[model samples]
Target: MPPSLLLQHAPCARPTAKRTASLFSAAVLASKDGGGARPPRPRPRGKPRFSRQSAIRKSFQQEQVVFSTPVSPDPTVAVIGGGASGLACASALAARGVRSVVFDTGMHGLGGRMATRAVDDERQLVFDHAAQFFTASDERFQKLVEEWVERGLVREWRGSIGELEAGGHFRPIHSSTPRYIGVNGMRPLADAMLPENDLIKVIRPSWISKLEPFNGLWRLFENEKPRGQYDAIVIAHNGKCANRLLSTSGLPQLTKQMKRLELSSVWALLAAFEGPFPIPHNNSYGTFEGAFVRGVDSLSWMANNTRKLFPFETDRPECWTFFSTASYGRRNKVPQENIPNATAEKVQREMLGGVELALGLSKGSLQLPFYTRVQLWGAALPMNTPGVPCIFDPQGRAGICGDWLTGSSIEAAVLSGISLGDHVADYFASCGERPEEFAIGLDDSLNRVEGHDIGQFPGLDSSQKPQVAEAQLTATI
Candidate 1:
């Protein structure tokens, strides 16, 4: 039998595109035929028949503009995160001939919430504590995911997934969209996205406490020590640390937008069991790889990490991850670095019991895991978004990108980072010249961008909508 998990209540403590243009060809053919009779009309004086437009519209500038520049140009960027967004941004910039230095506080590795933890005990249990799997709805992102799949960084997760209700009713989620996961864990996907050149330098386990502007360049500092100076800065992170770093960076508008971002907390519990769960199943259903738990106060999600990574093997230790609802996290929040043992035990007990209840198992009926741990995601997911692809402050030479700017997913983070990186590269190539098209997420009156379901979550109520005031449109410059 597995070791019993101890429980005790103690004192509180301590985170699509479309195209047109076929009819014109048919009209040209009909004009030249004998049935049309008259000769084709002469072209207008000094006007070519198919002259393409030179000026780009402000709304479509980011997608349409392409500039050529050599790699390792004069301008260097400082990317302040090594997660999906930051690495993707660095990769995109490197492709455009710009150099970038990425700084992250991840001790184990990059990939922020795309995290995985392995218990070093003899069992050697592995768990993807944060993001389980991701799907690509945009064609641009689908192409990138396909590339990762071909390179062995990612593969399709064909395991069973569904919604687990509080009454122990399970409804399998069926969708045509393909779900992808990293070969080992979610972190390797970000590792593979990184470019293989020296133009993009990565510095990990480094916390950037502040940013100081000197000689028209941003100098980063870890506490009092100066890290380096760069021509531009890309803030690929958010939450309290980010707010503190930019509180006095002299970029008032950028700071204001950062402050407006609302983030939520969550609790993830990782448990390693001896065997498969006792839930009954049939030939039509394989082991559950993931689920979005509904109507449960204490838990929101659960994933079978062992099945997800090694579906064919049954001899390995069974690993599972349970995610608490945002509200439950709020009620039991504590500092991640210094979680009291009492608090940890309490959370572990409550979450495990919650899981048992969801599975309709009697209280304490399930076998205890050989190992267990609890983690607090102080700023887990974004509660609101600016509904933009990315944010860039051209004048201050600072930009921001993450899942918050677009949607809460790995794909959103990558796309946001790539967009900001490409725009900054273009700005540098043009020698500090930019049109209004480069200014995004700056106008207070800007309409929310489409395709993102901001402030919408399974457990979020309508009253929880982000309270951002709509203002008159004003020039960012």
Candidate 2:
């Protein structure tokens, strides 16, 4: 079947796998055998209430460039990190007939945390090691997610999202907010949103090692070579990397804000079993494609990727992804010392041990994972997110956007970009050599989402992330 063709038989996620898997009745049935109900936790507050609907048709006719050159009339915006925030910013700029170049460090593809990997032994088995699923709570995000759903780029995951309490017990928490995921994997969703347009250009495996201010423009140095000159620079990276670059930009306030910002680290582990699921679900917690554990030592989240995404019953191994709690990640995150499998051994054991205790699986009963991989995500999650939708310093000609600016989750990341784009657009137009008319530039139409108190300017709602473990990774720049 074409990867884009939707599956009509998947059990957990409403959308069928874009590349692998089929029906997951067996997995869902097994989970149903051990199900229980739990109460919902109250939501957190103090997030920037997001509300905006700006539309700008593509109008720029100039050719796209890999590295910025002298382009009259059109200004260049360099966006670091080709993840959700970066792409969203580029896309928004493209719609406004603006020019932008995206620089990414990932060799695999654009999506940073929305990543996927194949098990070494089994080519068919795959896992989304970083971001698992996302929810749409804002109107702007809801509209975009709807379009993605219609385009087959995204699907709804009706995983019985539940909370794991103390002592390995589980409880199901009901919610109207539907969680969505990329069809094949998370990366494809971000990739699909970015089209090969004249307004937006992309460069991969290009890491910006230094950021220097040249006169009124910004010059980027990638791999120790002078890359290009950009009229404006958007820090779309996770806080740590962005903070590092901003420190050299000579923007004291912005650099200080990003530097003081703290983030949570995460150790993501992907494992594949020999055959169909080797573990059974416990009835007390209920069956969930994604689940989170609270008060559990070192363990944070676990997912049945095959069942949650592809849902096929092939003799091939089933895949699962595990994440360590922020606390555990901080304690164990250390530089590699050239010893092969040293970091892998300890992380893998810690994850597996958490799984064993959570499932009550005896060492022998629970088969060992045939395939395993460990990824260190430092500054993975934002701890204290700023209440502003984005940071736009006109004097600095630099702006900041990410989940951290808005709130964790894909929705927040996208919203942050859009909001930042609006600010950049207004600033760009007002200072241009000749004023150009824009479709809508934050005039009433960009009013705050109803009931949100973001002070005169509209900002993202502090729509708190209710479930961190299964809901996905958190952060922004």
Candidate 3:
């Protein structure tokens, strides 16, 4: 009989050499015992006639077994600023398969100090008012900048800047390498680093009021409401905001150290004119020691932004940015509305005088259409003092990384992010779990009592009680 017929007749059957031999012996023994022909040992109870068919079916079933691949978990990080520092942090985390959320109070845009303005008219124009130019000082940043240049997002500005002395003398300072600017505007650099989806969620018009440790997670509050939680937080803003956040959290060591940081302010004046002012190419930094104002230039830093400038708007004429002196920045304590008229008049007079000296142009010889606006940067740059640690890892888990932590430059910000990121990655490797990395100190202990002001922000309602089930059990025992 065929194996298929035999299997159909008896679902449970075995085909083995020992069993076949035993069945043959049993048949012979039965034949001798019985009077007539042996019963053939009852057909060996249900052995298949063809054994190969059973092996093929077993092999087929084995081949059909399914296997699953495991997926890695995504890490959560919170970036406090949307400026260059924060953007670089988010980008680095995203590249490592981590998700980051960037929060910025700056007007719905990415750039913090690297700001630009949009001019409205029959033909629109975008001009960069802040961060007049940037240079790459590190290999990592330099390589990234080269890539940006190749993509046409940035281009080199080639010219000699004439430095103005405090005594009204102007001298030219030569820069070997060209200064680079964004092709369209400075904000594109920040925009390019953000992820498309929730991997990087940018929250604009939302300011983080306070941060506290809640149930082993860092909870961030915005406007007294729980915004979100993060495994790690990167404060990329200026020293003032950083100091405020650290102090409000009640971290004594960080608070005490952050008090020493001092940030300088910058007041910027933006203007647009139809005709080009007579000045040397890349004319910048004219000094006036005795006068109220210091530096003056017609085209302080100008490019035929319409054509030569890669990232600038092509529909507009040459774009220029005039920088205010540090003295002017300190004196201008009033609002922005009152700054433009005085700044423009003073700068125009200085530029006209310089033009007459350079190109023999009288005051009325230049006919130009101009627009002026001023910006006051409360914390433009951070003072990098010696003996200051770039990162403060007092609690090991709690760390500070930003431009203020290192040198006050874009490169320093990037380096700070990279350094902190490595520290965080190494920290996870050392600890089996998150809590193991941070020892709960007596000073860091919570009140754990009900209706207490535990970890609540100032002026916020403290109705919610602390979840102390673990503490309650310890007290009961």
Q: Against the hidden reference, what TM-scores do the models get?
A: 0.78, 0.74, 0.62
Off by over 4 Å in 2: 1-72, 119-122, 166-168, 276-287, 312-314, 336-340, 432-477
Top lDDT prediction, candidate number: 1
Looking at candidate 3, what is the lDDT of residue 12? 18
Per residue, candidate 3 scores C-alpha lDDT tens digits across 1-477 of 001111111111122323323432333211122221222122223522322211112221121111111111223567788777677666655444345677888784886765667777655555665654566666666777787787788777554333343323455434455556677777677676554434456788678888664323356788667676555566767556677787655344445545655544454445566654444333344321111112332222222333334333443554544444333444553444355666646654544443344333454665554665545565654432322223433232355556555444455555566555445444433332443443222122112222110111112122233222211100000
Query: Each candidate: RMSD to true structure?
Result: 18.6, 17.2, 25.6
lDDT value, candidate 3, whole model: 0.46
Q: Give the TM-score of candidate 3.
A: 0.62
In order, candidate lDDTs are 0.67, 0.60, 0.46
Better of 1 and 3 by TM-score: 1
lDDT by residue (tens digit), candidate 1, 109-204? 988878888777776688888777777776667778888887888998878877676656676766667777888888777778776655567888
Model 1 superposed RMSD (Cα): 18.6
lDDT ranking from best to worst?
1, 2, 3
Candidate 2, run of 10 with poorest lDDT: 448-457
Tens-digit lDDT track for model 2 on 97-132?
A: 455778998888887776877544526877887777
User: Once model 3 is optimally superposed onto the true structure by TM-score, how far is the C-alpha of residue 270 displaced, in angstroms?
Assistant: 0.8
